[model samples]
Target chain A: MRITCPHCGERDHREFYYKGHALALERPSPDAGEAAWDDYVHQRENPAGVTRDLWYHEGGCGAWVVVSRNTLTHEVLGTQAASEARA
Target chain B: MGNLVAKSPCKGLLPLSVGAMSASEVETGAMTMLSPRKGQDGALDEAMRAVHGLGYPAPSGVESAGEARAIWFGHSSVLLVGAEPGQRLEEHGVLVDQSDAWAVVRLDGPGAEDVLARLVPVDVRLCAFPVGSTARSKIGHMSGSVTRVGEASFWLMVFRSMAETLVHDLKSAMEAVAARG
Candidate 1:
């Protein structure tokens, strides 16, 4: 697989590490209940279709990226810098 | 106070024969990493231009004037070589001393691209990489930042700790390419 990094352009997938879903970026409020925190930590919707996931360009630009892709076909629809995605 | 001496990471390995290509360490004094603070990219770019007469390069771009060059490191960061990153940029971002953190090497010769192709996965061809283009990619097993500086010339930077390994890898690749000729 090849990932098109915003800063590095198209690079081999070996250069990146999948960091689970992008939803992991959202954390529960400090005062939220245990159930809320638990859900945030353990709950993951492993949807087989299109999903937004996070990947780390550890071997390349060292930027965190949000990749919108199809889980089944491995088709990447788009990508954005994690900072920009969060913003 | 007593004086201190400078030592290169590729001390004995440099100037070594690598077939048609030669790998030499670059002494880039005062290398700095600049990352713009929140909502300050414009100000930082302006400050950089005012101080060094060079603007921050766009993504995957390299801007060089004389011996000084600015490499786009990531979305919000740049690596400044040759010229010192001025203090004014501090107001807009953080300045980091990277001179010792990275090892810079210049691979030059007619076989430079051939040698690199064996180790790097990116397309190093002139039409694909082009002069003044930079990218972060893997060189062998280590992460590297590569820039096409001139025809058949490339500037590669890797973590300081991996300098020796990188030199060895490049040498081996060069030798293999040379053997094919």
Candidate 2:
């Protein structure tokens, strides 16, 4: 698979590291309670359709990117820099 | 203190040639990494233009003025090569000396693109990656930078410690490409 990095253009998937869901960026506050913290730490939704996930461009630009992809078709819908992506 | 003589990272390991292609170590006088502070991109560009007669390069771009060149180094960063950065540049961004941290090799001659094709995944053809284009990509499992400096010349850089590996990989690719001729 090829990911088109916002800054580095298209690159091979080997250069990127998959970092699970993009929701990982939405961390709960320190005193948000056990359930919230537990969900934040361990809960994941394995949706079959479109999903937004985080990826690190470890070999190229070293930027965290949020990739919008379809789990069923493996088609990459879009990609944006993690910093610019809205939670 | 004992006398300490400086040694090049690719000492005795480069200046290799295989058929039409040659790989040689480049004496990068001073390499300074420029990363603009938040909201300081314009100021940094102005400072660079005033001090070095060059502006901040765009992503995957390279700007050159005389012997000095600035290569886009990853996101929000540029590597200034062959020039001593002025003190004014520090006010707008962070300037880190990277002269000793990278091993730069100049790959020149015919089939230079073919040699790099065996290593990097990026499409390095002149039509796709023209002169003055640069990219931070992997070179044979090692993350490195590739810049098209001329029609048939490319500048490749990796960490200083990987000089031998870089040379070895380039030599092997060079031989393989030449053998196909």
Candidate 3:
């Protein structure tokens, strides 16, 4: 459950806020109409198994991160800063 | 409690008169007016107004107007934990109870996540968790805000009444994790 933050060293779970999923969904254009926007905003596939998620460290440096965890067991497999994860 | 003048025949609190019965006032903390002479930073003030719709009056004797945020710890109190709570918090309209209505719980160390995992379903891993993030969630049945203050520490604001309950739960969970190790 303890994930080491690259900037803040090792921290406990209490300091981090859970942001759902690491997948970045693009917003549909305004011309795409209400249905397209609604579907894009409301519809998402919530898989039950292993997945990557977004979380915020509200207390730390205010950075964004992505975590890979087991859905059923709630075990965090790995975590990476969203910025670092990209590069 | 000058505000108690409206209600007649009050049972709990003392009535608003010289000869009125001295009754215990209802505890209403959480919204502590932590105003310094100086107010919130521009960015934080905007965020407070935009987010929580709060603006507290400046507390006397505080030279620095530290940054403020509109943070909800429970159902009743919306804490403005800084010099100024928020830009929109009406100082006059809303009652600001400067009493100690909340208990701040700081959770740090590597075992902190392991401790919280016992109750909170959300993952507390760093890679996914970002700093300056806030969540309205339940920690051991008490609904409150879990604000990440450090890479390893988070500040939990809970009702004073449930302070013992939360601490007990947190300790139990930590012990369980240690036992597993």
Candidate 4:
């Protein structure tokens, strides 16, 4: 998939790194205890079709990007900052 | 070594720390990372814009932290050339010391564009890929970004581990182009 890094020009997909899931996991507040943060850190729905994923351009600038893609085809639907996606 | 083989474009002098490596036959070159303050988009952008405004064409893409054209070398690193003179990191973003962690290479030659054509899907024809533009795509299974540096020269950012693989493919492609001629 060709990603036009708002910073670097499109090169090859190998330049960037794949960081799964762009949406930050929500954990219960401090009082929520271990189960909360544990689920947040370890659990992920690995859904197919349309999904929000985190991808880091490890090969390029190394920015964490929130990219929406199709799990089946690996087609990148759109990409933005992970922070913006949550908002 | 004291004299800048190529004067610093933005800074009056290339830091003594700044140096370049040349590709044996492919006319390729590499420069170690320097002053790449990661996340410090403000400083990076300001400096790069200053350089661009000074007249050299720098088209930055990272806008959030004010970084416009400088190439993001990787997650925490970026090509400083994209930043300009007045830019500084204190105001915004973060800088990571990525020196020795990765390698930088310049790819150019008479048939450089033709060579890239075999690897990248982007249009490498002079009229399309023209200088100053960049894109993130793939060269085989390896992913990276390509930045136009000169008439036949381009900046290719890849992981250090992949440097040998990339250079080999690039040199092979160049040879193939020459063979086709």
Candidate 5:
């Protein structure tokens, strides 16, 4: 897997570490119920199709990237800086 | 500051000359890491320009004016080498002293690229890396900041704690490249 870091350009996948789903960036509200918090904290959907995930470019640009990829084929569709994704 | 005795992180192991390539520790007088405060990039740029006659470099690029060189490290951050020590841009963002945090080394010679290709995964070819281009990349399992300072020279900065490891890795790679010649 190759990643095109926005800052560092294209680099090998060994430079990055998959940090799970991009949804992890959204946290549950402080006053939300236990079930809501539990679902937010522990629940994960094993979608085999296109999924948006987060990856850390630890060895490259140190940028948190949101990668759009297919879980089944492992084909990366696209990527963008996570900060820009949040914006 | 006058009481502090400067020390090279690589000690006496650097300034190595081997075959067509040579490696030496670079004495960067003063260095600072600058990060613009949220929504204050314009202000930071203006201030930096006033100080150094140049603004922060673009991604993977370098900007220099007089004795100061600004190399882009990541988004909205730059490493300013030769910046006046104790200088601060408090109103614009954060300024931290980085002179003692990194080990700066220079590798130059016709075969410098050959040696680097054996270690780093980045494309160090003259056409790819070009002079003034910089990148944060890994060198033998260690994170490092690499910048092309000249047509045949590169400056590499790694954590101070990893200086010895970097020297070992560089020597091994240089030796292998020389042996193959």
Candidate 6:
């Protein structure tokens, strides 16, 4: 698999470290309750189709990138810098 | 202070030639890392131009003015090579001395591209990675930077501690390419 890093251009997947789900960026408030914390920490959709996830470009430009891809086909739909994506 | 001497990272390990290719340790004088402050990108570029007569390089680009070269290090960072950071540059960004932090080696010859191709995953052919192009990639499991400096020459830099490993890897690849002749 190849991941197109926004700063480094397309590179082999070996250069990046996959961090599960883009939802990791959204953190629930401390007073949001136990169920919310549990869902945020332990739950995942595990869908079969398109998914957005975080990847650290460990061997390249050292950017955290949000990669949108189809889980079944492993085809990358698009990628954006985590900073820009968050904005 | 006690008497001390500075030794190059690749001391006695470089200036090696295998067939038509050669690798040598380069004297990278006073490397400085420049990282712009928040919302100071324009100011930093202006300072760089004023001080070094060169602007901050674009992503994966290298800009040179006389002996000074600005290499795109990573996101929002640049490495100034062969020159000292001026005081004016400090107003817009942080400048850290990095001269002793890296080992720079120059690979030159007809087989230079072929030797690097064996270790790095990037396409380093002249057509793909022309002169003044740079890339941060894995060099035989070690994260390093490769910059095309000439038509048949490249500058490769790795952590100072990895000098031996880098030379070993390059030597092996150089020998393999030579054996094919």
Candidate 1 residue runs with Cα over 4 Å from true position: B1-4
DockQ, prediction 1:
0.80
Q: Write the residue-wise lDDT of candidate 2 on B1-181 in tens digits.
A: 9999999999999899889889998998999999999999999999999999999999999999999999999988899999999999999999999999999999999899999999999999999999999999999999999999999999999999999999988888999999999
True contacts kept of each: 0.92, 0.81, 0.00, 0.53, 0.72, 0.69
Q: Is the docking of candidate 2 incorrect, acceptable, medium or high quality?
A: high
lDDT per residue (tens digit) for residues B1-181 in model 5: 4797767898888989889999999888788888999998888888888767888688999999877899898767788898672344667879888988999999998889998898788998999999999988998889889999999999998999999999999999999989988
lDDT string for model 2 (A1-87, tens) is 989899998899999999999986788989999999999988999999999999999899888999999999999999999988863
**Two-way lDDT contest, 4 vs 6, winner:** 6
Report per-prediction Cα RMSD to one decimal: 1.7, 1.2, 12.9, 8.5, 2.1, 1.2
In model 6, the clashing pairs are none
Model 2 chain A poorest ten-residue lDDT run = A78-87
Ranking by lDDT: 2, 6, 5, 1, 4, 3
Per-residue lDDT tens digits for candidate 6, residues B136-169, read: 8999989999999999999999999999999999
Per-model DockQ against the true two-chain complex: 0.80, 0.86, 0.06, 0.40, 0.80, 0.82
- Fraction of true A-B contacts recovered by candidate 6: 0.69
Docking class of 4: acceptable
What candidate 4 gets wrong by more than 4 Å, as runs, is: A1-19, A23-28, A41-43, A46-49, A70-76, B1-44, B47-77, B81-106, B120-122, B134-145, B156-167
Q: What is the DockQ of the complex in model 5?
A: 0.80
- Ranked by DockQ, the better of candidates 1 and 3 is 1
- Give per-residue lDDT, candidate 6, residue B129: 98
- In model 5, pairs of residues that clash are none
Candidate 5, residue B3: Cα displacement in angstroms equals 8.3
- How would you encode candidate 6's per-residue C-alpha lDDT over A1-87 as one tens digit per residue? 988888889999999998989996788999999999999999999989999999999898889999999989988999999989988
Please give the distance, in angstroms, between residue B116's alpha carbon in candidate 4 and its true position after superposition: 1.3
How many backbone clashes can be found in candidate 6?
A: 0
Local error of candidate 2 at A58, Å?
Answer: 1.1
Q: Candidate 6, residue A82: CA error in Å?
A: 0.6
